[model samples]
Target: MGLLTNLKDSVSRVTDRLFASEDPKRIGIYGPPNAGKTTLANRIARDWTGDAIGPESHVPHETRRARRKEGVDIERNGQSVTIDIVDTPGVATKVDYKEFLDHDIEKDDAIRRSREATEGVAEAMHWLREDVDGVIYVLDSTTDPFTQVNTMLIGIIESRDLPVLIFANKIDLDQADIDRVADAFPEHETVPLSALEGDNMDEVYDKIAEYFA
Candidate 1:
């Protein structure tokens, strides 16, 4: 048993080193639905690579697929890191078609959207387990931070030993609270920003370079 444990540890170290040395680390942008994750991802991709990852919508589960933009070279204060930005679908414990119906979506479309969103969430988890090197966990600052889905996702990320930066998005709103989000995840660094208004993006870029690198 001791010898087997040692072998596993050695393999883990080698895997870590290999991933660390690779260029353009894969960084996943993850959060709940309607958290402005796609907005932030579009901002980053446009700023550096002159591209967009996906469309944004006010409705929940708008992003029902994981989108990727490769070779985005982000530089801040002379620190730089090349990364493949993966904007993943929202991680949710429960997705109901009724939520889509509330958005005035028709029955058939709402049900289909719910199914796709659920599959997307599963795909996002798969990426975290096998593909992503780091995580950018976004949260809506206007909402309560203590959620079962949020806790479960963060715990999964921690278990995989992935470096994560929590983003408190939609700070332009009057009800947005950065401190609450920070308090929710005291172990991880949280950055307050309005992804829609392009506020405090420099800090985000700098932190990404610092943490993910």
Candidate 2:
């Protein structure tokens, strides 16, 4: 049964990719705040296009708007894939301005950023349903993987039957555990890497070329 199931899945993926349209696949980077979503997206851009998608900061909600780097050309094992990198703002159920103050942001700016972050989350949710062809779900490996947001995100992704790659980011941390992340989302594939150090990025590229291209 397991072998038959695997065979069926393989055939489905091949059929899906063969019928997939257009030149550039839209790959969205999504996860909780400070999960290195933008950093990874920028890393992919830098690898392919000699540029970063957007500036990244330590402050939560720093990326309060969706950013896209279009037409990033990647070639792996003679298989070429053009991708539009969509770096979305963090997904969160609540946005409190006071949290921004911890990052040394002023009250007024924090409040504005908070509002924008709320809107950004909504926009990210919209893109998950409406725009993306595939998703890279980034998770801070040092943190516990079980969370309400993760459940919602995964459920939505699965419902759409979209290709997903769960990224267990920040693996350089002493407490980082890829097993925890894999156990948390056993239904999907997870790649462990340190986006800050550019570790194991080739695996990500290879997965994109193999599964999403």
List where candidate 1 sits over 4 angstroms from the true fold: 1-19
Lowest summed lDDT window (length 10), candidate 2: 1-10
TM-score of each: 0.89, 0.96
What residue pairs clash in candidate 2, if any at all? none
Cα-based lDDT for every prediction: 0.91, 0.91
| Tens-digit per-residue lDDT, 1-213, candidate 1 | 277865775576456655777677799999999999999999999999898999999998999999999999998777567899999999899999999998889999999999999999999989989999899999999999999999999999999988789999999999999999999998788999999999999999988877666
For every candidate in turn, the CA RMSD to the true structure comes to: 6.0, 1.3
- What ranges in model 2 sit over 4 Å off? none
Worst 10-residue lDDT window for candidate 1 reads 9-18
